[model samples]
Target: MPVGHFPLQDKIVVITGGGSGICFSFAQLALTSGARGILICDLQLTPAAQDLINQTPDEVHFMKCDVTDWNDLEAIPPKVEEAFGKGQVGDVWIAGAGVFEPKWSSFIYDEEKEGGYKAMRINAEHPIKLTRIAMRSAISVNKPCAVLIVSSGAGITGQYAAALYCATKHAVVGFTKSMGQADIDENCKIVCILPGMVSTPLWTGRSDAVASQFSYTDEVCITPEDVAQGMKEMIEEEKYPGGSLMSIAKGKLRNVLESKLAFANDGSEIYKQFESKCYAPIREIWNGERGTKLS
Candidate 1:
């Protein structure tokens, strides 16, 4: 059988925080995958987003946007609708916003002077607000759509001296999961991506917290191309809807904790129970059978 071609052809996609870093990388990949029109929005319309647009064959547009500002997010739908000559977006990617500032002595410590609110507003709140707007736009257009939220491993497991950053990431994960259930129409998918310390300008001139935590020899880390590849794979696969897909360093993909767990009884017994009681029953119900009748 022939392999499927890029599924994003002619799709109107919107990416917030698209001016730099992983978001920009994703935009480049989306263009290669045949995206028709892309709107790259960031807090300050940087030349970088436009630069990516210039390099691609796709029709790319850039917008100056601050994700924390609800009005700015609310305005995006109409702008995108006008561009596409329709009031709905096909796919929306929330990648342009993130913060990795260090935390103070305590959990309650606030560092307004060091851009703490910027972290929370961009990393957590902005994605949630953007998702709402995108979902509404998708529904109004009556088209299938997907929302990809960029999260961090810190969002999954809290790190020392990074409480605020962790809090925001965790919030993103929660928001993705909650929205996934509420907005599960045949045409909508919500996904959260947990990226671990990709190399980008976002980390430039920043503290060594990420390097130290990940045990990097030099300050260098995973590249933007690496992250862009992962994003492209996830979008193309389409198997991970409403799920948190984690991309870690090579040779470290599996969840070792889950794999190595030793149950009280043998694994086969557990599998039997799960298959007979859970999977089998659910499959039967989904297939429109009342119950299995053993003759």
Candidate 2:
């Protein structure tokens, strides 16, 4: 309830998917805030990241990584502390690893006799794995921690014809919220950002393409910097509580009350009744033994 603020000064920060886009912006801003060290973990370095690499302070380092691989991801923390110092692994981690839906494939693709769920692997599972790794390492070192999960508007509103991408992002949103609530008195705070149509290579799949797509004009599309800044404020300002979700679009951000239950009037029996009706099928299928039967 009090005016809250946390500083990143001299903290060792770890960011997965920091090679470009909003993650790069976070890396840049973090250095300006006096971060002691930073590790950029990406599939590989990109040309766009060269300048950032050049500008990194004495201790910040970049490395090639595959977030989907547990061995690759788990190897990051030790390397970070070894470079920075032991038990000084620092607590700020941004799980920004993700990928867009396939240009030609559906949620489930059978290519060459092998079915794959690529989006689910990169966009959802990677974040969950990396977050777990970061939290476990931080807790073992007795450090305070925070994690930011990068999701998309699809996390809130499922996309048509892009079910896999939408499903993965939605999973991230749910996971972040659930973890925050599960560890309310814990040391780390988990947050999620649902960005809409940001200006980045992720949208066009080509470097030359405009940031806008899907009827969203270039002017209306938010820049990656916009998302980065909004997210920074949301965390540093402490305006939003742990487990809070916010929607970012066109350079503005506001709380996302995605569920009616979040704002239902105190003593609103109608909402209770409506919720019961809405959840009856789910309850019937998911409650204990009832969930085991197929029929």
Top lDDT prediction, candidate number: 2
Residue 217 lDDT, candidate 1, scale 0-100? 43
Off by over 4 Å in 2: 1-4, 108-115, 204-213, 256-295
Candidate 1 Cα misplacement greater than 4 A, ranges: 1-6, 45-48, 55-58, 86-90, 102-109, 113-116, 205-220, 253-295
TM-score of 2: 0.79
lDDT of 2: 0.70
Residue-by-residue lDDT tens digits, candidate 2, 100-128: 65543345443322365656778898888
Lowest lDDT block of 10, candidate 1: 256-265
Q: Tell me the TM-score of each prediction against the true structure.
A: 0.73, 0.79
